[model samples]
Target: MLTRSFPRLATLRYPLVLAVALMATACGKGTESTAPAASTPAASTAATPTDTAATPAAATAPAQTRQPGPIVPPQGPAPVLGTDYEEIPGGQPWQPEPGKVEVVEVFGYICPACAAFAPTVEPWHMKLPADVNFHYVAAPFGPEWIPYAKAYYASEQLGLVDKTHMALIDAIHVKKTLPGEGDPVNEQKIADFYGQYGANPKQFLDMMQSFAVSTKINQGRQFMQKSGVTGTPTIIIDGKYRITGGKSYQDVLRIADHLIAMERAAMAGTPAAAPAAAPAAPATGTGG
Candidate 1:
């Protein structure tokens, strides 16, 4: 089993405060204004300005695009409504399914807090029950962050996410092979990274600038706007509850588990369980 220590909580109220503070650093370190959505002017419509000069020529086309198969999640204790998660009025799943409980994490590749939360959540996701569906919606918090988000959708289109998701995170944070927050972004470099995992660099770059990728990016932005997500590493439970408080990464998972259990019970027409002990630990760090 994965192991982590829960810091002693000094006060229940501080986690939200600390979460807010940490989320501020999740994204938007770049000096430019946030990119416009697809509805905006054409000048700003591309996910990122295509850097043709930066991309290396490709000898092969990208593999055919494919839809991703489903994945799963797990359960935990009863959680507090406002403290552990906040309800979104008229909220809907990012992608609704009839029988599965969906858990979506809104994250940015360059967000430090997201980088920190990734390892903890990666293994946690693998253990989820077969009925649960886990998804990721990449957040392009600034102009510099857009290329990474586009690369994400392109990877999804090419069915490379299952292999390269974690590696891409490492590319930005650990390996320093790709640009992060302040460094100049090269779409070619981003596409070239996927090339290592069998994606054709040219086709990947082309897909990154494709209409489908732009639509997905805009869709994600609208979902984040609708869900009130403003930072990286934020979890949405069945598109209803926005995870807003957790003293640590473990606490976040605990609350998610609790909520998942609640969702499961609701699906079966049974009452939810009594509240578990609320997480009592200092906020570990920021998410974005």
Candidate 2:
């Protein structure tokens, strides 16, 4: 059985705040300037300018052409810790579904940390190797968090999460709306937001409160507690390793990569290489 604990609430530190600001600025600039280069100004009409010079005739040579090399992806720095976590005596060992490493993010819809980490998490998802299974576990940290968790599962049931996930994040983070802050967590308010994305508001509300959805929310809470997570934006690798988002949002992805490698090694029945040691901290939201 998973033990439950009250979640710790804290604000992100300054360095992370600064990084988020810069990333947002860079994304905005990239979108605004993505158009192809304006047709190069037609080659100069006149001959090259020359300060008077007496020169001998030169032999004409074919223009040298350069072939572009294969595109290479940038390899950023690795994560600080490995993903594999040993079970607390008598706890279940994480076993992923066949042929895949499971990556689960334990998150709360109202968490500023989860919102801050969304953009950084996108690229990592895009680059995941084929033998990986990624999932989101919406944590029910309190009564107020239940509604949002339900909405997340409802969207998943309807196969609409791809369209709704980032939209919900943007609604909360950018629009500054607190859909998950009131008593009962405002199910209707969340449904209305989903309506804008072509989901039926009435259907969304009905489904968000159904027993089936609520059960999933409870399961998410249980999973969080089992993994020793006490905060939002925590990552559980194959249900074995737990990594929390730190001052640097990048740590989340780094830990994810480490876990993936570890899971792969274990599956192959090969001893995984040891990673360098790092500081040890309790799983109470200080960053993974």
Candidate 3:
């Protein structure tokens, strides 16, 4: 069975199953959700009936990622330091720029949890204050993850990230047009995938293997190590804190908002009040 091919995906399946369940609940609540317009045969052989029995939990990937709605700042007390987030000792921004508060996400395109979080985080990131900077650092957890990480940097180099970021996620998770888990990892196939978005396949492949991309991959690896990031969908606030626990993805963003506010205030010379101690929260299942 295809699940046997990538045993590591045991951690990735929970979020996929959860996303599908949430989609069902939203429909029951009378909220209509639209699946992506593009439909293609699933790349995973695991989706076949013969293999589906092995990983029944993740048979149906979420049809629709949660849409961006009104930006409601999380309503609650400030996030507690130890319970909500952890400080990254001696950490520094992945790419520092003066006067901008940096928020970086260490994620993997192949990781289902990161796929689930993308729809939620992308909207929040879009609404960030002008003084705040949001960056994505692709996590290269294994061989299957490296090509997509390279694709990210290459797309970044070609100024295609803004256009292709969400689409790539959709291709991998929803449409399943591109290779993800339980599928052969082909660099050329990934390059051809970008060709549809105006990038020449040959040139995209060259850029993927370029020195600039390699440097970024290495830099991102070192940053994850220093920040003590252990999983995908992990958020880093100003490189000083790595969000460790939250009851939900919303709670994760809520904690991120609190931390961003604190950072914003600190920058303006008006530090926010210390948050009261709260009991430790459950780990938001970030796919390892």
Candidate 4:
């Protein structure tokens, strides 16, 4: 017969053994942040568990990306049509008369607006069709405007305009340098710049002061006065329309296009296609 074992002692012994085993395992491991080395093969083979929640949260987060849509341009006031100044019909608006469809740009060198308009008009000049004749009328509005006009004619006479025209604009607008005001328009200064274009200094001066050149300048002044242009950068199209402000530049071109089509129609002796009847009376007015 075996001695009787206490049931409570048996139960307590297993719990005590478990506590000691856990305490021994913990004590064996140091308080450092590193994980304990795996001893058993199965423990080594198993993957170490990770929080994993942080990775999915990080991956699901939105990325920094650009917004999608068509980019809109800055808005400004709509362009106005014509000025309040005197209206001179370019004389038979659509006809291609001797001086008709003449695009006369009344400009003064000292005027910054004239300088700005120079480049815009250049390309238009190159591509101008046969019906449209373009010209630059040096506006002799004052004593200051006269010399620059003379310089312009001088450049024309010497056949040096293609080289010097843009240079003059750049000199005034970009470089902030004035060629000074006087009769004969200071050939030496222009020569200094134009010599780069193979123009002789003395010859350039002589032609600039010649009677022929002076006559051309007078003609330009007369044209401006006749056109009733009191301000510069006025674009006189077909000797029938005048565009004064910067806004008018494009309108002037548009009018020119219209006039060109009209001219072609008149030449072909064919009527333009009629438009759909309108509900209200349409605005009938002349534009540059």
Q: Cα-based RMSD of the predictions, in order?
A: 12.5, 19.3, 12.1, 37.5
Candidate 2 regions exceeding 4 Å error are: 1-95, 177-184, 244-247, 278-288
lDDT of each structure? 0.65, 0.53, 0.65, 0.45
Instruction: Provide TM-scores for the models.
Output: 0.73, 0.65, 0.73, 0.56
Higher-ranked by lDDT: 1 or 2: 1
Model 1 TM-score, 2 decimals: 0.73
Residue pairs clashing in model 1 are 9-280, 22-286, 25-288, 26-288, 27-288, 73-128, 73-129
Superior candidate under lDDT, 1 versus 4: 1
In model 3, the Cα lDDT at residue 141 comes to 57
What TM-score does structure 3 among the candidates reach? 0.73
Q: Rank the candidates by TM-score, best first.
A: 3, 1, 2, 4
Model 2 lowest lDDT segment of ten: 26-35
| Model 4 TM | 0.56
The true-structure Cα RMSD of candidate 4 reads 37.5
Q: What's the lDDT for residue 141 in model 2?
A: 50
Stretches of candidate 4 exceeding 4 Å from the true structure:
1-100, 180-187, 244-248, 263-269, 272-288
Q: What ranges in model 1 sit over 4 Å off?
A: 1-32, 37-77, 274-288
Model 4 residue 108 lDDT score? 61
* Model 3, total clashes: 0
Give a tens-digit lDDT track for model 1, residues 43-70.
Answer: 1110211121211111012322234334
lDDT per residue (tens digit) for residues 1-288 in model 2: 011111112332222442343233211000111112211111111111111110101101121222323323223444444322333222222335786878777666665546555655644664677777778888665555566778899988887777667667666656545453332447788989888778899999999988889778767656655676544555677776665323244544655676678778888898976654556766777675
Count of clashes in candidate 1: 7
